[model samples]
Target: MRIKTTRQQHILRIKTTLRWLLYYLLIFLSFIIMTSGTLYKPILLVPLAIAISINNNIYGSAVTGAFCGFLIDICCGKLFGYNAVILAFFCILTNLVFELYLKNRFINYLMITAVVSYIQCWLDYKFYYQIWDYENVGRIFVRVSLRVWAYTVISAFFMYLLVKLVNKLLMPKEHLTIEEAINTNIQNENKR
Candidate 1:
């Protein structure tokens, strides 16, 4: 069983810290792009939020989602906590789904991001604009949901690729095979 040397451990720690820093930088850029509002609409925040959630632990994901959502809300001038609440809930939902059913696959992440983006669009229309006219309800829902879903799916692919790339670059490759792990465990036991 090969153990990592002290110098290697220190390098690993630095890499981990840099990886997390890159994550925050990506998230901040997403917030800025989404809030710029130069496009017809923006879906970067939702998919990026979901990507972060998928890559982190449940509580960590929740906190990240809430913080990003809060920034979004402040940028959009919505109710103080509205975006934060919805984003945190969506993050928790996706994290639970990942834990229970979905593998950490790109397709699953894309689908979840699309679904969450659609739901967020619906909520935005309802709360921000109060669009309650029954006659145009179906039309509005179909139009907004599809547009948001499309943009979100596109953005999800980019964010997914970014995560994969950064993880590959910054994280250490786990060289310990199952047999190695078992041997190390036995050796530790003998030492104790």
Candidate 2:
């Protein structure tokens, strides 16, 4: 049994802290981008929901979703707390599914994103148009169809790529196996 040196443990802690900071910073920046209206109605929320699902941290993802949803509500000028509630629910749900069955694959993300996108669009349409009676089904369908692909789908792909890249950058390298560690120590001793 080998114990890690104090310096080594300290370094590891620092690395972990730094990684978390980077991850949160990235999320914050993305939240700002989504709310700033700079992208001409980007579909950032759905992808963000999917990203939280794949994030593997229920509490953290839920919090992030809530924050982003709040920002979204502010930007859209809709009733406060509506998007926040929906996004938080989806975040928790997605995290559970990913933890139990899914492996965070791209295809899985795409399918999940598509479903979420549909739900989001429907909700937005319903709430914005106040279509409780559902009288004009044709117009709703046409509008949904046009807006679904107009920016959300493409923005989702972009957000996916961004998430992947950020994950790759922040993820720590794999730890050495016991055998590798021993070999490394032996090689270092030989050099000394």
Give candidate 2's whole-model lDDT. 0.71
lDDT of 2 by residue, 1-192 (tens): 344666666766776677567656766776667676543566576676567558647987787677767877886787898888888888788888988999878888877777777787677776776566667765765665446535776677777777777667655455665677899999999999
In TM-score terms, candidate 1 sits at 0.78
Report how far off residue 29 is in candidate 2 (Å): 3.6
- Model 1's number of clashes is 0
- Encode model 1's per-residue lDDT on 89-164: one tens digit a residue: 9998898899889998988998888778878777887764556566666666567656766877787888888878
Candidate 2 shows a clash count of: 0
Note the Cα lDDT for every prediction shown: 0.79, 0.71
